[model samples]
Target: MESIDRRLVHALQIDGRAPFAKIAGVLGISEHTAARRYQRLKERGIRVRGALNRFRLGHHAWTLRLRCTPDAGPALAQALARRDDTFWVHLMSGGTEISCLQQVKNPDELLLDRLPRRLVDVSAHNVLRGFASPGTWRGLACLEPDEVAALRPEFEPEPPTELTPLDEALLGTLEVDGRAGYADLAATTRTSESTARRRVEHLRRTGVLELRLDADPSRFGFATQARLWMRVEPRSLAAVGVTLATHSEVYFAAATTGPANLVASVTCRSGGDLYRYLTERIGSLDGVRETETAPVLRTLKRVALSEGEAFPCHA
Candidate 1:
Protein backbone atom coordinates (compact mmCIF):
# COMPACT_ATOMS: atom_id res chain seq x y z
CA MET A 1 0.00 0.00 0.00
CA GLU A 2 1.13 3.54 -0.70
CA SER A 3 1.79 6.10 2.03
CA ILE A 4 -1.36 8.05 1.14
CA ASP A 5 -3.47 4.91 1.45
CA ARG A 6 -1.91 4.10 4.77
CA ARG A 7 -2.67 7.61 5.94
CA LEU A 8 -6.27 7.21 4.87
CA VAL A 9 -6.55 3.88 6.69
CA HIS A 10 -5.00 5.38 9.79
CA ALA A 11 -7.49 8.21 9.69
CA LEU A 12 -10.31 5.69 9.45
CA GLN A 13 -8.84 3.68 12.32
CA ILE A 14 -9.05 6.85 14.40
CA ASP A 15 -12.65 7.46 13.35
CA GLY A 16 -14.24 5.26 10.70
CA ARG A 17 -17.15 7.59 10.05
CA ALA A 18 -14.92 10.65 9.61
CA PRO A 19 -16.16 12.94 6.89
CA PHE A 20 -14.40 12.81 3.54
CA ALA A 21 -13.60 16.51 3.93
CA LYS A 22 -11.94 15.82 7.27
CA ILE A 23 -9.92 12.94 5.84
CA ALA A 24 -8.99 15.04 2.80
CA GLY A 25 -7.85 17.95 4.97
CA VAL A 26 -5.64 15.69 7.03
CA LEU A 27 -4.21 13.85 4.02
CA GLY A 28 -3.77 16.99 1.92
CA ILE A 29 -6.06 15.54 -0.78
CA SER A 30 -9.35 16.75 -2.16
CA GLU A 31 -12.55 15.33 -0.72
CA HIS A 32 -13.36 13.69 -4.04
CA THR A 33 -9.93 12.10 -4.12
CA ALA A 34 -10.33 10.82 -0.61
CA ALA A 35 -13.71 9.32 -1.46
CA ARG A 36 -12.37 7.73 -4.61
CA ARG A 37 -9.39 6.23 -2.83
CA TYR A 38 -11.64 4.83 -0.11
CA GLN A 39 -14.01 3.27 -2.64
CA ARG A 40 -11.09 1.69 -4.46
CA LEU A 41 -9.63 0.42 -1.22
CA LYS A 42 -12.98 -1.02 -0.20
CA GLU A 43 -13.12 -2.93 -3.45
CA ARG A 44 -9.61 -4.18 -2.74
CA GLY A 45 -10.67 -5.65 0.65
CA ILE A 46 -10.48 -2.77 3.12
CA ARG A 47 -13.76 -3.15 5.00
CA VAL A 48 -15.47 -1.36 7.87
CA ARG A 49 -18.17 -2.85 10.12
CA GLY A 50 -20.01 -1.75 13.20
CA ALA A 51 -19.80 -3.79 16.43
CA LEU A 52 -21.33 -3.56 19.85
CA ASN A 53 -19.09 -3.01 22.85
CA ARG A 54 -19.72 -6.24 24.76
CA PHE A 55 -17.85 -5.37 27.92
CA ARG A 56 -19.45 -1.95 28.08
CA LEU A 57 -22.84 -3.63 27.91
CA GLY A 58 -22.16 -5.99 30.82
CA HIS A 59 -21.65 -9.02 28.56
CA HIS A 60 -19.02 -11.71 28.98
CA ALA A 61 -16.58 -12.34 26.15
CA TRP A 62 -14.72 -15.64 25.91
CA THR A 63 -11.91 -16.94 23.71
CA LEU A 64 -11.95 -20.66 23.00
CA ARG A 65 -9.10 -22.86 21.89
CA LEU A 66 -10.15 -26.14 20.31
CA ARG A 67 -7.94 -29.00 19.33
CA CYS A 68 -9.76 -30.95 16.69
CA THR A 69 -9.23 -33.87 14.36
CA PRO A 70 -7.33 -33.04 11.23
CA ASP A 71 -10.35 -33.39 8.93
CA ALA A 72 -12.86 -31.65 11.20
CA GLY A 73 -11.01 -28.34 11.56
CA PRO A 74 -11.90 -26.56 8.37
CA ALA A 75 -15.54 -27.60 8.27
CA LEU A 76 -15.97 -26.86 11.97
CA ALA A 77 -14.34 -23.47 11.54
CA GLN A 78 -16.62 -22.60 8.64
CA ALA A 79 -19.66 -23.59 10.64
CA LEU A 80 -18.52 -21.39 13.49
CA ALA A 81 -17.86 -18.49 11.14
CA ARG A 82 -21.36 -18.58 9.71
CA ARG A 83 -22.88 -18.03 13.13
CA ASP A 84 -23.65 -14.49 14.25
CA ASP A 85 -22.18 -15.01 17.72
CA THR A 86 -18.69 -16.14 16.83
CA PHE A 87 -16.83 -13.11 15.49
CA TRP A 88 -13.14 -14.10 15.33
CA VAL A 89 -12.34 -17.64 14.23
CA HIS A 90 -8.90 -18.83 13.16
CA LEU A 91 -7.47 -22.16 12.06
CA MET A 92 -4.10 -22.38 13.71
CA SER A 93 -1.30 -24.95 14.17
CA GLY A 94 -1.70 -26.22 10.65
CA GLY A 95 -5.48 -26.45 10.82
CA THR A 96 -5.50 -28.70 13.87
CA GLU A 97 -6.30 -26.05 16.41
CA ILE A 98 -9.17 -23.56 16.27
CA SER A 99 -9.31 -20.24 18.06
CA CYS A 100 -12.65 -18.55 18.47
CA LEU A 101 -13.91 -15.47 20.29
CA GLN A 102 -17.56 -14.92 21.15
CA GLN A 103 -19.59 -12.80 23.53
CA VAL A 104 -22.38 -14.13 25.71
CA LYS A 105 -24.79 -12.58 28.14
CA ASN A 106 -24.41 -15.56 30.51
CA PRO A 107 -20.98 -17.09 30.91
CA ASP A 108 -22.61 -20.36 31.89
CA GLU A 109 -23.61 -21.08 28.31
CA LEU A 110 -20.00 -21.64 27.23
CA LEU A 111 -18.26 -22.38 30.51
CA LEU A 112 -20.50 -25.30 31.42
CA ASP A 113 -22.67 -27.97 29.78
CA ARG A 114 -21.20 -27.53 26.31
CA LEU A 115 -18.31 -29.62 25.06
CA PRO A 116 -18.22 -31.19 21.63
CA ARG A 117 -17.20 -34.82 21.74
CA ARG A 118 -14.46 -34.85 19.17
CA LEU A 119 -10.76 -35.64 19.10
CA VAL A 120 -8.50 -33.79 21.57
CA ASP A 121 -9.17 -30.99 24.03
CA VAL A 122 -10.78 -27.57 24.49
CA SER A 123 -10.10 -24.61 26.73
CA ALA A 124 -12.23 -21.57 27.34
CA HIS A 125 -10.82 -18.35 28.73
CA ASN A 126 -13.00 -15.56 29.94
CA VAL A 127 -11.55 -12.23 28.90
CA LEU A 128 -10.96 -10.35 32.13
CA ARG A 129 -10.20 -7.19 30.20
CA GLY A 130 -8.78 -6.08 26.90
CA PHE A 131 -5.67 -3.92 26.72
CA ALA A 132 -5.89 -3.58 22.96
CA SER A 133 -8.39 -4.46 20.26
CA PRO A 134 -8.90 -3.63 16.57
CA GLY A 135 -10.10 -0.17 17.52
CA THR A 136 -7.10 0.66 19.73
CA TRP A 137 -4.25 -0.99 17.82
CA ARG A 138 -2.06 1.71 16.27
CA GLY A 139 0.39 -0.58 14.50
CA LEU A 140 -0.95 0.73 11.20
CA ALA A 141 -0.98 4.34 12.33
CA CYS A 142 1.22 6.19 9.82
CA LEU A 143 -0.21 9.67 10.28
CA GLU A 144 1.59 12.30 12.30
CA PRO A 145 0.44 13.02 15.84
CA ASP A 146 -1.37 16.20 14.93
CA GLU A 147 -3.01 14.52 11.99
CA VAL A 148 -4.27 11.71 14.20
CA ALA A 149 -5.51 14.20 16.78
CA ALA A 150 -7.40 16.07 14.11
CA LEU A 151 -9.19 12.89 12.98
CA ARG A 152 -9.95 11.46 16.42
CA PRO A 153 -13.54 11.74 17.57
CA GLU A 154 -14.27 13.61 20.76
CA PHE A 155 -17.04 12.47 23.07
CA GLU A 156 -17.77 12.75 26.75
CA PRO A 157 -17.80 9.58 28.82
CA GLU A 158 -21.35 8.29 28.72
CA PRO A 159 -23.37 5.88 30.78
CA PRO A 160 -24.33 2.60 29.14
CA THR A 161 -27.46 3.08 27.09
CA GLU A 162 -29.60 0.04 26.53
CA LEU A 163 -30.62 -0.76 22.93
CA THR A 164 -34.14 -1.29 21.70
CA PRO A 165 -35.26 -3.84 19.11
CA LEU A 166 -35.35 -1.11 16.50
CA ASP A 167 -31.74 -0.25 17.27
CA GLU A 168 -30.77 -3.86 16.67
CA ALA A 169 -32.52 -3.80 13.30
CA LEU A 170 -30.55 -0.68 12.41
CA LEU A 171 -27.26 -2.28 13.51
CA GLY A 172 -28.03 -5.27 11.31
CA THR A 173 -27.30 -3.08 8.32
CA LEU A 174 -24.20 -1.47 9.82
CA GLU A 175 -22.75 -4.81 10.83
CA VAL A 176 -22.37 -5.50 7.12
CA ASP A 177 -21.50 -1.97 5.95
CA GLY A 178 -20.43 0.58 8.51
CA ARG A 179 -20.35 3.41 5.98
CA ALA A 180 -23.92 2.76 4.78
CA GLY A 181 -25.80 5.98 4.08
CA TYR A 182 -28.46 7.21 6.50
CA ALA A 183 -31.16 6.62 3.91
CA ASP A 184 -30.18 2.97 3.57
CA LEU A 185 -29.99 2.55 7.31
CA ALA A 186 -33.42 4.10 7.78
CA ALA A 187 -34.93 1.91 5.12
CA THR A 188 -33.46 -1.27 6.61
CA THR A 189 -34.93 -0.42 9.98
CA ARG A 190 -38.17 0.82 8.40
CA THR A 191 -37.90 4.18 10.15
CA SER A 192 -37.62 7.82 9.09
CA GLU A 193 -34.18 9.09 8.08
CA SER A 194 -34.12 11.62 10.92
CA THR A 195 -34.87 8.95 13.53
CA ALA A 196 -32.22 6.62 12.17
CA ARG A 197 -29.61 9.41 12.08
CA ARG A 198 -30.43 10.49 15.63
CA ARG A 199 -30.20 6.94 16.96
CA VAL A 200 -26.85 6.24 15.32
CA GLU A 201 -25.35 9.42 16.70
CA HIS A 202 -26.62 8.58 20.17
CA LEU A 203 -25.15 5.08 19.95
CA ARG A 204 -21.79 6.43 18.84
CA ARG A 205 -21.63 9.02 21.63
CA THR A 206 -22.58 6.45 24.23
CA GLY A 207 -19.71 4.09 23.33
CA VAL A 208 -22.17 1.37 22.34
CA LEU A 209 -21.09 1.18 18.70
CA GLU A 210 -17.52 0.77 17.47
CA LEU A 211 -16.66 1.02 13.79
CA ARG A 212 -13.93 -1.54 13.04
CA LEU A 213 -11.79 -1.49 9.91
CA ASP A 214 -11.02 -4.99 8.62
CA ALA A 215 -7.81 -5.00 6.64
CA ASP A 216 -5.70 -8.14 6.73
CA PRO A 217 -2.18 -7.75 8.09
CA SER A 218 -0.84 -9.56 5.03
CA ARG A 219 -2.04 -6.71 2.86
CA PHE A 220 0.34 -4.39 4.74
CA GLY A 221 3.35 -6.72 4.24
CA PHE A 222 3.01 -8.62 7.50
CA ALA A 223 2.90 -12.14 6.21
CA THR A 224 3.40 -14.06 9.46
CA GLN A 225 0.58 -13.92 11.98
CA ALA A 226 0.61 -15.88 15.24
CA ARG A 227 -1.10 -16.09 18.58
CA LEU A 228 1.14 -15.72 21.61
CA TRP A 229 -0.22 -17.55 24.63
CA MET A 230 1.97 -16.61 27.56
CA ARG A 231 1.84 -17.99 31.05
CA VAL A 232 2.85 -15.00 33.09
CA GLU A 233 3.38 -14.48 36.77
CA PRO A 234 0.01 -13.55 38.21
CA ARG A 235 1.34 -10.38 39.79
CA SER A 236 2.86 -9.01 36.56
CA LEU A 237 0.15 -10.11 34.11
CA ALA A 238 -1.51 -6.73 33.92
CA ALA A 239 1.73 -4.85 33.24
CA VAL A 240 2.89 -7.40 30.68
CA GLY A 241 -0.43 -7.30 28.82
CA VAL A 242 -0.44 -3.51 28.69
CA THR A 243 3.17 -3.36 27.48
CA LEU A 244 2.64 -6.00 24.79
CA ALA A 245 -0.36 -4.10 23.45
CA THR A 246 1.90 -1.12 22.71
CA HIS A 247 4.18 -3.12 20.43
CA SER A 248 3.85 -2.68 16.68
CA GLU A 249 3.59 -6.41 16.01
CA VAL A 250 0.72 -6.99 18.41
CA TYR A 251 -2.73 -6.19 17.01
CA PHE A 252 -4.69 -7.77 19.84
CA ALA A 253 -3.85 -8.33 23.51
CA ALA A 254 -5.86 -9.14 26.57
CA ALA A 255 -5.68 -10.50 30.10
CA THR A 256 -7.82 -13.52 30.67
CA THR A 257 -8.54 -16.20 33.26
CA GLY A 258 -7.13 -19.68 32.68
CA PRO A 259 -3.72 -21.32 32.34
CA ALA A 260 -2.32 -18.73 29.97
CA ASN A 261 -3.14 -15.43 31.62
CA LEU A 262 -1.93 -13.13 28.85
CA VAL A 263 -2.64 -13.59 25.16
CA ALA A 264 -1.70 -11.57 22.11
CA SER A 265 -2.10 -11.79 18.34
CA VAL A 266 1.00 -10.61 16.47
CA THR A 267 1.84 -10.14 12.81
CA CYS A 268 5.32 -9.98 11.37
CA ARG A 269 6.82 -9.64 7.95
CA SER A 270 8.50 -13.05 7.86
CA GLY A 271 9.57 -16.07 9.90
CA GLY A 272 12.76 -14.23 10.78
CA ASP A 273 10.73 -11.26 11.95
CA LEU A 274 8.66 -13.51 14.19
CA TYR A 275 11.82 -15.08 15.65
CA ARG A 276 13.26 -11.68 16.47
CA TYR A 277 10.01 -10.67 18.12
CA LEU A 278 9.94 -13.81 20.29
CA THR A 279 13.61 -13.72 21.27
CA GLU A 280 13.95 -9.96 21.64
CA ARG A 281 10.55 -8.47 22.42
CA ILE A 282 8.84 -11.27 24.33
CA GLY A 283 11.95 -12.84 25.81
CA SER A 284 12.85 -9.58 27.56
CA LEU A 285 9.57 -9.52 29.43
CA ASP A 286 10.32 -10.71 32.98
CA GLY A 287 6.76 -11.78 33.70
CA VAL A 288 6.27 -14.02 30.67
CA ARG A 289 7.39 -17.34 32.08
CA GLU A 290 6.54 -19.65 29.21
CA THR A 291 5.26 -18.84 25.74
CA GLU A 292 3.38 -21.05 23.31
CA THR A 293 3.28 -19.82 19.74
CA ALA A 294 0.36 -20.94 17.54
CA PRO A 295 0.85 -19.86 13.95
CA VAL A 296 -2.44 -18.75 12.40
CA LEU A 297 -2.73 -20.76 9.21
CA ARG A 298 -6.03 -19.14 8.23
CA THR A 299 -8.66 -16.81 9.59
CA LEU A 300 -12.18 -17.84 8.58
CA LYS A 301 -13.96 -14.97 10.29
CA ARG A 302 -13.14 -11.61 11.62
CA VAL A 303 -15.86 -9.03 12.38
CA ALA A 304 -17.79 -10.53 9.46
CA LEU A 305 -21.55 -10.47 9.86
CA SER A 306 -24.09 -11.36 7.21
CA GLU A 307 -26.50 -8.68 6.05
CA GLY A 308 -29.30 -10.07 8.20
CA GLU A 309 -27.10 -10.87 11.20
CA ALA A 310 -28.62 -9.55 14.40
CA PHE A 311 -26.10 -7.98 16.79
CA PRO A 312 -28.65 -6.09 18.89
CA CYS A 313 -25.84 -4.05 20.54
CA HIS A 314 -25.57 -6.79 23.16
CA ALA A 315 -22.79 -8.89 21.66
Candidate 2:
Protein backbone atom coordinates (compact mmCIF):
# COMPACT_ATOMS: atom_id res chain seq x y z
CA MET A 1 0.00 0.00 0.00
CA GLU A 2 1.10 3.53 -0.72
CA SER A 3 1.66 6.03 2.08
CA ILE A 4 -1.51 7.85 1.10
CA ASP A 5 -3.48 4.61 1.31
CA ARG A 6 -2.19 3.99 4.81
CA ARG A 7 -3.21 7.48 5.81
CA LEU A 8 -6.65 6.97 4.31
CA VAL A 9 -7.11 3.72 6.20
CA HIS A 10 -6.05 5.39 9.43
CA ALA A 11 -8.51 8.21 8.89
CA LEU A 12 -11.32 5.75 8.24
CA GLN A 13 -10.33 3.82 11.35
CA ILE A 14 -11.00 7.02 13.26
CA ASP A 15 -14.39 7.66 11.64
CA GLY A 16 -15.64 5.03 9.21
CA ARG A 17 -18.29 7.37 7.86
CA ALA A 18 -15.99 10.26 7.07
CA PRO A 19 -16.61 11.42 3.51
CA PHE A 20 -13.97 11.09 0.83
CA ALA A 21 -13.86 14.84 0.35
CA LYS A 22 -13.31 15.28 4.07
CA ILE A 23 -10.59 12.67 4.07
CA ALA A 24 -8.93 14.21 1.04
CA GLY A 25 -8.97 17.59 2.72
CA VAL A 26 -7.39 16.17 5.84
CA LEU A 27 -4.73 14.31 3.86
CA GLY A 28 -4.02 17.29 1.59
CA ILE A 29 -4.89 15.25 -1.49
CA SER A 30 -7.44 15.59 -4.24
CA GLU A 31 -10.84 14.09 -3.50
CA HIS A 32 -10.49 11.90 -6.59
CA THR A 33 -7.21 10.41 -5.33
CA ALA A 34 -8.70 9.65 -1.93
CA ALA A 35 -11.81 8.05 -3.42
CA ARG A 36 -9.83 6.06 -5.93
CA ARG A 37 -7.49 4.71 -3.28
CA TYR A 38 -10.39 3.65 -1.04
CA GLN A 39 -12.07 1.94 -3.98
CA ARG A 40 -8.89 0.11 -4.79
CA LEU A 41 -8.49 -1.03 -1.19
CA LYS A 42 -12.10 -2.22 -1.07
CA GLU A 43 -11.58 -4.16 -4.30
CA ARG A 44 -8.62 -5.82 -2.64
CA GLY A 45 -11.01 -7.03 0.15
CA ILE A 46 -10.49 -4.31 2.75
CA ARG A 47 -13.72 -3.22 4.47
CA VAL A 48 -15.15 -0.93 7.11
CA ARG A 49 -18.32 -2.01 8.90
CA GLY A 50 -20.37 -1.21 11.95
CA ALA A 51 -19.90 -3.58 14.90
CA LEU A 52 -22.01 -3.92 18.01
CA ASN A 53 -20.49 -3.15 21.42
CA ARG A 54 -22.08 -6.20 23.05
CA PHE A 55 -20.57 -5.46 26.45
CA ARG A 56 -22.07 -2.01 26.40
CA LEU A 57 -25.40 -3.60 25.57
CA GLY A 58 -25.25 -5.70 28.75
CA HIS A 59 -23.87 -8.81 27.08
CA HIS A 60 -20.87 -10.84 28.26
CA ALA A 61 -18.05 -11.36 25.76
CA TRP A 62 -15.96 -14.52 26.01
CA THR A 63 -12.99 -15.93 24.12
CA LEU A 64 -13.03 -19.70 23.67
CA ARG A 65 -9.97 -21.77 22.92
CA LEU A 66 -10.44 -25.32 21.71
CA ARG A 67 -7.76 -27.92 21.28
CA CYS A 68 -8.60 -30.73 18.91
CA THR A 69 -6.83 -33.68 17.34
CA PRO A 70 -5.03 -32.74 14.14
CA ASP A 71 -7.61 -34.62 12.05
CA ALA A 72 -10.57 -32.85 13.64
CA GLY A 73 -9.17 -29.33 13.89
CA PRO A 74 -10.23 -27.77 10.61
CA ALA A 75 -13.71 -29.26 10.59
CA LEU A 76 -14.27 -28.37 14.20
CA ALA A 77 -13.10 -24.82 13.63
CA GLN A 78 -15.46 -24.48 10.68
CA ALA A 79 -18.34 -25.81 12.75
CA LEU A 80 -17.74 -23.22 15.42
CA ALA A 81 -17.40 -20.54 12.78
CA ARG A 82 -20.83 -21.45 11.43
CA ARG A 83 -22.47 -20.90 14.79
CA ASP A 84 -24.31 -17.62 15.37
CA ASP A 85 -22.64 -17.22 18.75
CA THR A 86 -19.02 -17.48 17.55
CA PHE A 87 -17.88 -14.29 15.85
CA TRP A 88 -14.18 -15.05 15.42
CA VAL A 89 -12.59 -18.40 14.67
CA HIS A 90 -8.85 -18.75 14.16
CA LEU A 91 -6.51 -21.63 13.46
CA MET A 92 -3.46 -21.40 15.65
CA SER A 93 -0.60 -23.71 16.76
CA GLY A 94 -0.34 -25.44 13.38
CA GLY A 95 -4.10 -25.86 12.92
CA THR A 96 -4.58 -28.07 15.98
CA GLU A 97 -5.89 -25.20 18.11
CA ILE A 98 -8.84 -22.90 17.52
CA SER A 99 -9.60 -19.62 19.24
CA CYS A 100 -12.91 -17.83 18.97
CA LEU A 101 -14.83 -14.94 20.50
CA GLN A 102 -18.47 -15.26 21.58
CA GLN A 103 -20.92 -12.96 23.29
CA VAL A 104 -24.05 -13.75 25.32
CA LYS A 105 -26.56 -12.00 27.52
CA ASN A 106 -27.07 -14.66 30.22
CA PRO A 107 -24.52 -17.42 30.55
CA ASP A 108 -26.11 -20.59 29.22
CA GLU A 109 -24.92 -23.80 30.84
CA LEU A 110 -26.12 -25.84 27.88
CA LEU A 111 -24.12 -23.78 25.39
CA LEU A 112 -20.85 -25.70 25.86
CA ASP A 113 -22.65 -29.01 26.41
CA ARG A 114 -24.14 -28.64 22.94
CA LEU A 115 -20.72 -28.53 21.30
CA PRO A 116 -19.82 -31.54 19.17
CA ARG A 117 -17.85 -34.13 21.13
CA ARG A 118 -15.08 -34.02 18.55
CA LEU A 119 -13.17 -31.40 20.59
CA VAL A 120 -10.58 -32.53 23.10
CA ASP A 121 -10.37 -29.49 25.37
CA VAL A 122 -12.31 -26.24 25.62
CA SER A 123 -11.67 -23.10 27.66
CA ALA A 124 -13.69 -19.92 27.77
CA HIS A 125 -12.68 -16.52 29.15
CA ASN A 126 -15.09 -13.71 29.78
CA VAL A 127 -13.78 -10.44 28.30
CA LEU A 128 -14.33 -8.34 31.39
CA ARG A 129 -12.76 -5.27 29.77
CA GLY A 130 -10.98 -4.07 26.64
CA PHE A 131 -8.02 -1.72 26.43
CA ALA A 132 -8.04 -1.33 22.68
CA SER A 133 -10.01 -2.48 19.66
CA PRO A 134 -9.83 -1.94 15.90
CA GLY A 135 -11.94 1.15 16.34
CA THR A 136 -9.45 2.59 18.81
CA TRP A 137 -6.12 1.51 17.32
CA ARG A 138 -4.41 3.95 14.96
CA GLY A 139 -2.66 1.68 12.52
CA LEU A 140 0.87 2.34 11.26
CA ALA A 141 0.79 5.67 13.09
CA CYS A 142 0.30 7.24 9.66
CA LEU A 143 -2.10 10.04 10.36
CA GLU A 144 -1.02 13.37 11.84
CA PRO A 145 -2.41 14.30 15.23
CA ASP A 146 -4.42 17.16 13.71
CA GLU A 147 -5.76 14.90 10.99
CA VAL A 148 -6.74 12.31 13.55
CA ALA A 149 -8.34 14.96 15.71
CA ALA A 150 -10.28 16.29 12.74
CA LEU A 151 -11.57 12.84 11.87
CA ARG A 152 -12.45 11.72 15.40
CA PRO A 153 -16.16 11.27 16.06
CA GLU A 154 -17.78 13.13 18.90
CA PHE A 155 -19.26 10.50 21.20
CA GLU A 156 -22.12 11.57 23.46
CA PRO A 157 -22.71 8.93 26.12
CA GLU A 158 -26.30 7.76 25.96
CA PRO A 159 -28.06 6.12 28.86
CA PRO A 160 -28.48 2.37 28.46
CA THR A 161 -31.67 1.45 26.63
CA GLU A 162 -33.43 -1.84 25.99
CA LEU A 163 -32.88 -3.34 22.53
CA THR A 164 -36.13 -4.24 20.86
CA PRO A 165 -36.37 -6.72 18.02
CA LEU A 166 -36.41 -3.82 15.63
CA ASP A 167 -33.20 -2.59 17.22
CA GLU A 168 -31.54 -5.99 16.68
CA ALA A 169 -32.61 -5.98 13.05
CA LEU A 170 -31.13 -2.54 12.60
CA LEU A 171 -27.91 -3.59 14.34
CA GLY A 172 -27.61 -6.68 12.15
CA THR A 173 -27.88 -4.56 9.04
CA LEU A 174 -25.36 -2.02 10.25
CA GLU A 175 -22.99 -4.79 11.28
CA VAL A 176 -22.75 -5.66 7.59
CA ASP A 177 -22.57 -2.12 6.32
CA GLY A 178 -21.83 0.52 8.88
CA ARG A 179 -22.40 3.11 6.19
CA ALA A 180 -25.69 1.63 5.00
CA GLY A 181 -28.20 4.23 3.93
CA TYR A 182 -31.28 4.82 6.00
CA ALA A 183 -33.52 3.76 3.11
CA ASP A 184 -31.73 0.42 2.93
CA LEU A 185 -32.02 -0.04 6.70
CA ALA A 186 -35.71 0.89 6.63
CA ALA A 187 -36.35 -1.59 3.84
CA THR A 188 -34.53 -4.39 5.64
CA THR A 189 -36.33 -3.81 8.97
CA ARG A 190 -39.78 -3.11 7.37
CA THR A 191 -39.90 0.23 9.13
CA SER A 192 -40.27 3.76 7.90
CA GLU A 193 -37.05 5.51 6.91
CA SER A 194 -37.41 8.03 9.71
CA THR A 195 -38.00 5.30 12.23
CA ALA A 196 -34.97 3.39 11.01
CA ARG A 197 -32.86 6.49 11.36
CA ARG A 198 -34.20 7.20 14.83
CA ARG A 199 -33.63 3.64 16.04
CA VAL A 200 -30.04 3.54 14.70
CA GLU A 201 -29.25 6.87 16.26
CA HIS A 202 -30.71 5.67 19.54
CA LEU A 203 -28.59 2.51 19.47
CA ARG A 204 -25.43 4.47 18.81
CA ARG A 205 -26.22 7.02 21.52
CA THR A 206 -26.79 4.22 23.98
CA GLY A 207 -23.40 2.61 23.10
CA VAL A 208 -25.09 -0.54 21.79
CA LEU A 209 -23.49 -0.13 18.34
CA GLU A 210 -20.13 0.87 16.88
CA LEU A 211 -18.85 1.31 13.33
CA ARG A 212 -15.31 -0.10 12.77
CA LEU A 213 -12.82 -0.35 9.95
CA ASP A 214 -11.59 -3.90 9.52
CA ALA A 215 -8.45 -4.41 7.45
CA ASP A 216 -5.42 -6.65 7.16
CA PRO A 217 -2.62 -5.26 9.30
CA SER A 218 -0.11 -6.94 7.01
CA ARG A 219 -1.40 -4.94 4.10
CA PHE A 220 -0.51 -1.74 5.94
CA GLY A 221 2.98 -2.92 7.06
CA PHE A 222 2.27 -4.56 10.42
CA ALA A 223 2.99 -8.11 9.34
CA THR A 224 3.11 -10.04 12.62
CA GLN A 225 0.18 -10.57 14.97
CA ALA A 226 0.07 -12.62 18.14
CA ARG A 227 -2.24 -13.39 21.06
CA LEU A 228 -0.74 -13.08 24.54
CA TRP A 229 -1.94 -14.80 27.67
CA MET A 230 -0.49 -13.63 30.97
CA ARG A 231 -0.97 -14.50 34.58
CA VAL A 232 -0.85 -11.55 36.94
CA GLU A 233 -1.06 -11.49 40.70
CA PRO A 234 -4.58 -10.81 41.87
CA ARG A 235 -3.62 -7.58 43.59
CA SER A 236 -1.96 -6.20 40.43
CA LEU A 237 -4.43 -7.45 37.84
CA ALA A 238 -6.20 -4.12 37.61
CA ALA A 239 -3.01 -2.11 37.47
CA VAL A 240 -1.40 -4.39 34.91
CA GLY A 241 -4.53 -4.42 32.78
CA VAL A 242 -4.81 -0.64 32.83
CA THR A 243 -1.15 -0.31 31.89
CA LEU A 244 -1.44 -2.82 29.05
CA ALA A 245 -4.49 -1.05 27.74
CA THR A 246 -2.49 2.14 27.28
CA HIS A 247 -0.05 0.53 24.84
CA SER A 248 -0.66 1.22 21.14
CA GLU A 249 0.25 -2.32 20.05
CA VAL A 250 -2.27 -3.93 22.39
CA TYR A 251 -5.47 -4.34 20.39
CA PHE A 252 -7.81 -6.19 22.77
CA ALA A 253 -6.90 -6.99 26.37
CA ALA A 254 -9.20 -8.25 29.10
CA ALA A 255 -9.37 -10.12 32.41
CA THR A 256 -10.57 -13.68 32.06
CA THR A 257 -11.17 -16.79 34.23
CA GLY A 258 -8.56 -19.24 32.90
CA PRO A 259 -5.18 -19.93 34.51
CA ALA A 260 -3.94 -16.99 32.49
CA ASN A 261 -5.92 -14.22 34.07
CA LEU A 262 -5.21 -11.75 31.26
CA VAL A 263 -5.34 -12.11 27.46
CA ALA A 264 -4.19 -9.60 24.86
CA SER A 265 -3.94 -9.41 21.08
CA VAL A 266 -1.12 -7.43 19.53
CA THR A 267 0.03 -6.52 16.03
CA CYS A 268 3.59 -5.46 15.29
CA ARG A 269 5.75 -4.59 12.34
CA SER A 270 7.91 -7.68 12.54
CA GLY A 271 9.26 -10.47 14.73
CA GLY A 272 11.86 -8.11 16.19
CA ASP A 273 9.13 -5.70 17.23
CA LEU A 274 7.27 -8.51 18.93
CA TYR A 275 10.41 -9.48 20.80
CA ARG A 276 10.92 -5.93 22.02
CA TYR A 277 7.31 -5.78 23.15
CA LEU A 278 7.63 -8.98 25.14
CA THR A 279 11.10 -8.45 26.58
CA GLU A 280 11.09 -4.70 27.13
CA ARG A 281 7.49 -3.66 27.58
CA ILE A 282 5.65 -6.64 28.95
CA GLY A 283 8.72 -7.99 30.76
CA SER A 284 8.95 -4.72 32.65
CA LEU A 285 5.52 -5.03 34.17
CA ASP A 286 5.56 -6.16 37.79
CA GLY A 287 3.31 -8.93 39.12
CA VAL A 288 3.09 -10.64 35.72
CA ARG A 289 4.02 -14.22 36.62
CA GLU A 290 3.78 -16.19 33.37
CA THR A 291 3.22 -15.47 29.69
CA GLU A 292 2.36 -17.57 26.65
CA THR A 293 2.25 -16.39 23.03
CA ALA A 294 0.45 -17.82 20.03
CA PRO A 295 0.86 -16.58 16.50
CA VAL A 296 -2.43 -16.34 14.55
CA LEU A 297 -2.06 -18.35 11.35
CA ARG A 298 -5.45 -17.56 9.84
CA THR A 299 -8.43 -15.55 10.96
CA LEU A 300 -11.66 -17.24 9.84
CA LYS A 301 -13.75 -14.52 11.41
CA ARG A 302 -13.08 -10.95 12.58
CA VAL A 303 -15.76 -9.40 14.77
CA ALA A 304 -18.49 -10.60 17.12
CA LEU A 305 -21.12 -10.13 14.42
CA SER A 306 -22.37 -12.81 12.04
CA GLU A 307 -20.17 -13.86 9.14
CA GLY A 308 -20.26 -11.81 5.97
CA GLU A 309 -17.93 -10.02 3.48
CA ALA A 310 -17.27 -7.53 6.25
CA PHE A 311 -13.50 -7.87 5.95
CA PRO A 312 -11.44 -7.42 2.81
CA CYS A 313 -9.48 -10.65 2.58
CA HIS A 314 -12.20 -12.94 4.00
CA ALA A 315 -14.87 -11.25 1.94
Best by TM-score: 1
What 10-residue stretch in candidate 1 is worst by lDDT? 306-315
TM-score of model number 1: 0.94
Candidate 2 lDDT for residue 85: 59
**TM-score of model number 2:** 0.88
The residue ranges of model 2 lying beyond 4 angstroms of the native Cα positions read 304-315
lDDT scores in order: 0.81, 0.76
Question: What are the TM-scores, per candidate, against the unseen true structure?
Answer: 0.94, 0.88
On the 0 to 100 scale, the lDDT of residue 177 in model 1 is 87
Candidate 1 lDDT, tens digit per residue, 1-315? 998898888888888888899899989999999999999899988877887665567777788899998888998888788876676788999989998787778877663345456648888888877777766666797888999889999887678777999788877788888888899998889999999998888878877777888778898899999988999999898788778868899878888889898878898999999999999999999888999999999988877562111122211
lDDT of 2 by residue, 1-315 (tens): 778888888888777777788889999999999888888887876777776666675677788888878888788777777766566577887887888777777778325777777778988877765555656664556787888899887768688677799998987888777778889999999999999988887776766676766666777678888888999999999888878767878766777887898887788999999999999999999999999998877777675343221111100
What lDDT score goes with residue 105 in model 1?
Answer: 80
